[model samples]
Target: MTSFQDKAILAEHAIRGVLPPTPLQRNVHLSEAFGADIWLKREDLSPVRSYKLRGAFNAMRKVLAGDPGKADFVCASAGNHAQGVAYMCKYFQVKGTIFMPVTTPQQKIDKTRIFGGEHIEISLVGDYFDDTLRAAQAYCADIDGHFLSPFDDEDVIEGQATVAVEIEAQLGGMPDRIILPVGGGGLSAGVRSYVGDRCALTFVEPIGGACLLAALQAGGPVDLRKVDTFADGAAVGRIGVRTFDRLRDVSLVDMIQVSEDRLCITMLEMLNIEGVVLEPAGALAIDALKDLREQIAGKQVVCVASGGNFDFERLPEVKERAQRFAGLKKYFVLRMPQRPGALKEFLGILGPEDDISRFEYLKKSARNFGSVLIGLETKRAENFDALLSKLEAAGFTYTDITDDEILAQFLI
Candidate 1:
């Protein structure tokens, strides 16, 4: 059996042919506030803006090692993995076909193309990822090209373990605890395998895409009925079978599930207060620390901020979601009396600190009353209580749609 040190050395030799190790930076703000020495493994700062490149490099290298004559490879990914494979194709001078969902962002497609150059072919197929994956799989079978599994393959897992190897060497030793964000579990599995019993592990998964949570509950991998793609990087419907096998013995309690909205709050907090731009999935480890406050306090901890491929166009939506999750902003449907002075009367009842961000009449449902969607932003969360009390006192019938998913879909 190859020691983790040897595997890491081999990976280092492999990856140096591509890019340098991602930085492991001590987070002053988090360390100061959490009463612990906190560090961030900035995989987001990698060449692919993610650790996916590690797995892609390792897998492609091993494949070529086995059959140097073969030059064709294939993979399907909506984002990071596609770029990883494309970059590797360019590096190895191999021909590869990269399949991506038609709905994937142009930014990602452009990056993949720029990285692969003439070494890769980009195929835009199907609207959903599942469809694109099936298309890629079929195409691989038809052409006899090697298909790369994003997180399930052994070589890929070994490659991702390089993160742990670097972390140990860079930090001078293992941290007391390592909080990891689990999507399909490749990184977590790799780190756990490398760390062994050297350090404790806290695995965080998005509530909407809690594949790890579901797998633990069911005693094996099981498909989730639904997956919310807000945290697109971590929104996996099922944990990879190989990954779950590696993590089967981990205690269920060691895994934490964070709501998508709550993750948005942390992303916004890191960006606004700390000037750190974190994608929703990238904020998982930081957000997980909130749940383990007592356990991690005064302990040396490392949180892997997985990736920062955040689209700035989503910043406003992220801020709105964070505000709502924090209870500092709300949307409500108010049944207003269709009188000349009714809007003025309601406007006067609002607190000085409460600002009307959105006000739109939905439809006149009744002759006397009209339904209006109102969005309110406040300086403090407590101000919302005062506004609600004022509305009640004035006999204004209103329904808070801030937490109502169905209503918010159309109204908000």
Candidate 2:
């Protein structure tokens, strides 16, 4: 086997020929907010709008280099990874077939098709990525095509290490800390291997898909009972064996689990304030800085901006989530007396800043009262406190369901 350092350096040199190094730019907003020298490793600027292309290119090049007869490659992905593999297939002039979940957005499907051009074929199968991955593996075996894992493979991990290679070179040395957004562990593991404790490492994962944290707790990789796919790029039911092996000893204290809703706010802030778009997974590391504000203060820290393949259609949902997470929006089930002046009285109770976004009568729970579902928005989160206080003073009964995931999914 080739040495990891050798493979990573080889990837850095070769990839530089394919594309310019992604910038390591100092972020003024983030630096000021964290009271630290915050730099963003903008992998979001990569040709595939992600760092996945690094791994895909490395893995494919090695396969064809070792076995010149290899002509085809296969991979399963829901978002960035598929496009990365597709783009690399075209670059290598190798035949490729990408399997994606049927639930994948049409925009992503179109982008993947555009990247691969005539060098690839796409098959939409399964509603979930796990099912799609299985079908892809079976088809790869049947056709004798080399299966390219999005992570897990040694070459892929080595390729991802090139990210660290560039970071160190671009920064002139390792920073005081490097925060990495982890999926199946490839990027985290690769960066971990490259830094080798010279710089402190913080692994960031979406709370809904914190497979790395689960693995650390179980002493090995374990399949999660359920995974929230909101952060699709980093959401994995199980961490990869090879990748986890490298990350097995990572400290729990160094891992930051970012809630899906909380991450939505970070995504929006980057897009609106920084004018840099980031996918959910891409925002994980930057989100962690909120939790690590004290720890990273006055230190040189780097946050990996993992990807930027966000669909504009999802913008509304992202805004809703961000608002809810920040407490600027909420949902409530109110019991209203079935009388003409009841709503008017309730409306009068609302503060000047509080606005009702959604109002629907759910059902008549009693002869005199009806259950009403209400979605409220306000300029300030604290305004809800005063508004709710006034509602109670007016003899209104309401159930706050903003934080209730299951209830919101059904009722809201």
Candidate 3:
């Protein structure tokens, strides 16, 4: 049996004919910001714009090597994984049937089609990923097609380990720390298996979909009651059993849960500052840097930029989340007196830096007062405190709905 490192080395060699090793560039901006020698393992630059293709290619190559006639493959994914499998199918000239949730963005679906071209067929089934997965598995079983798991299978894990292999070669040695963004734990497991205790390892997950954190807490894999699909690529409800087995011994302290809103901030910063487009899951490792700044100060750190398959259509939503997280934007429901000058008075209360992004009177005409829905954006978070003070001094009754999730979801 090949050892984990040996399998990773083999996988790397197998894939080199088709795909080059992704760049491992030192990011001066991030390094200066964190006071560390920060290097980005640019998995986002992969042909499929994610590390998923590495595992997909490795697994398919192994399978086809074993049985030259095995030509049918199947997988279920909402985005990244579908693209990876589709690209690999096209490369290997195998017939692939990819199942994706109906809610998946047209951009992702179209990209998958482009990647697979004539070798793949896409089936839009079910409303959610779980439903789509079930459909894919059943179709695979019925058709006797090989079902490719995104992260669970050993071959996939071994394939993902090639990332570690490349990193070691590129950096000439392991960094002091490796930050991995965990979804189903394929990348994290692979990297951990290869690196072992050679360096510190940190696993990050979106707070809304912290399956690995939950698993560590429970001492086993446990399904989350709900997952926030905002970070669709990393919104897995549960960690894979095989992945959990590989990572079960990892200390829970090394796992970090990042909020979806915080992820938006990271995405925006990367795009605006670095000109880098990162999907929410891809931003996880970069966002984790904030929490590890002190620990990694003056140390060499590697953050795996997991994916860059971001849809530009979501830019507005991403900006909104980033603004909200930074406290530079807010929503409020204000009780305005039913008077001609009331609106003017409220507007006057806003600081010079404050800009009203949204304003709507909930009730156009009320007996004594009208409820006004207002969205405010300011230069700094501190601007809100002054604005609120001014509102209070002016005898305005208002409810800050900025942090009120239920109200924001219903009205904002």
Model 3: per-residue Cα lDDT over 255-370, one tens digit each: 89999999999999999999999999999999999999889999999999999999899999999999999999999999999978988998888888999999998984569898
Point out the worst 10-residue segment of candidate 1 by lDDT. 4-13
What total of clashing residue pairs does each candidate reach?
A: 0, 0, 0
Encode model 2's per-residue lDDT on 143-210: one tens digit a residue. 99999998999989998999999999999999999999999999998888878979999999998999
In candidate 3, list every pair of residues with a backbone clash: none
Ranking of all candidate structures by their TM-score, best first? 3, 2, 1
TM-score of each: 0.97, 0.98, 0.99
Model 1 C-alpha lDDT versus the unseen true structure: 0.90
Better of 1 and 3 by lDDT: 3
lDDT of each: 0.90, 0.92, 0.93
TM-score of 1: 0.97
Better of 1 and 3 by TM-score: 3
Ranking by lDDT: 3, 2, 1
| Runs with alpha carbons beyond 4 Å of true place in candidate 3 | none
